[model samples]
Target: MTHPFPPLVEAYLADLDRALEGADPRERSETLAAVREHTREALALRGSDDDAVRHLLEELGPVDSIAAAAAAGTPAPTPASGPPLADTLLVVLSVVSLVLFIVPLFAVGTVVWAGTRLRAGAGDRSRQKTALVIGVVALVAFLAVLVSHYVATA
Candidate 1:
């Protein structure tokens, strides 16, 4: 008798998945990926009746079942990698760069510029940090002296 569930494609995928359960790690990976691709293709040609799903299932077999089976047998796959460098560090430098003046603005500015470039090029965070520190300190020292001189006179 023709099976009642018109979602034959889904049934076939389930069976395929079951079969893959008994497969080796490498075999399971390839089989599951292939079945997933077939599933995509089947979805694209989707029909209103269950017949299309059945037909696709007949053509593809039980992929989800195969996947379930494979899952039962083996370990999970690896995930994707993440990016380096943090947003916080970048923000810190930006904030610090603004509160500077006094140390021959040009010289301090150049250090900040070169330090920023160095950090970007070499992936060395310390370079920019050091530059920022030097600029701020020199500027503060100069300002302190000027303030002292003015205060003593007045």
Candidate 2:
């Protein structure tokens, strides 16, 4: 189906609609309309460029997570006025660990912790995802370095 929104926004809304399958019809319709209206208003204010749309979707969070909340008859938490302190700390530590390469295991641990918090919906979703990505990249780089050292020594 054609939508007036940009492709990214259309795809996101489609995913959200799919995720809401099996939910109450009234709830599903209301949720979709609310989301569409919210998206339109945000785009009108922020501009509908790809980056802006992407950021909007991130703030909205994962489609499955939203659908799950709806199915449980719970309102999704509104975006926090500020990023949570724990989320900020974890993201900072993840970046520092990656840059320093001083504690590869600790970097991996922080990523895992961030993932758990993300799944439990305990912090800023976008920040948690960022931490996860940084940690994984750091772990992979650390492993590559170790492998190279072993090969060179042997």
Candidate 3:
């Protein structure tokens, strides 16, 4: 008999499929089916609450890791390397220069460019946090400079 899944389950499956994009077709199908079956079993045993679903997914770990394990016999895809030092430096410099009389737009642009690189690069938790913090601090500092300039000019 077919079982019905919550909307979140469908979304999760789609995300999982996307994560397994470059994997072998056969292995991908098997992995998807296995995950679905596991989800169904979890739903059956524990009520269909959001918490239960989250717990199940967490226990299964990330889809990328799962795909890698399934394809253990084959060479794994190259993981994303950490963000470049140049990108980090650009973000820091932009943020620090917020106090300069230069156009704020340039500083904002640099922060955005650096942030995109940090987010897109490999899953380096430390680097991600550093980039995020730097971005926020830069923005705040820039805004402060703008306000101060406006007040001074008036």
Estimated TM-score per prediction? 0.31, 0.49, 0.44
Off by over 4 Å in 3: 73-154
lDDT of 2 by residue, 30-90 (tens): 8888888878766664567788788889888898888888888887555544766888898
Deviation of model 1 at 47, angstroms: 3.1
lDDT of each: 0.52, 0.81, 0.65
For model 1, where is the 10-residue window of minimal lDDT?
75-84
Model 3 per-residue lDDT at 16: 83
Q: Find the candidate with the highest TM-score and give its number.
A: 2
The segments of candidate 2 whose C-alpha lies over 4 angstroms from its true place after superposition are 1-3, 80-154
**Model 2 clashing-pair count:** 0
Compared with the true structure, what per-residue lDDT tens digits does model 1 show for residues 42-122? Answer: 444343256645555555433454466456664333222221243235434444544444435643564556465554543
> What is the model-wide C-alpha lDDT for candidate 2?
0.81
Error of 1 at 51 (Å): 0.9
Candidate 1 regions off by >4 Å?
1-11, 61-154
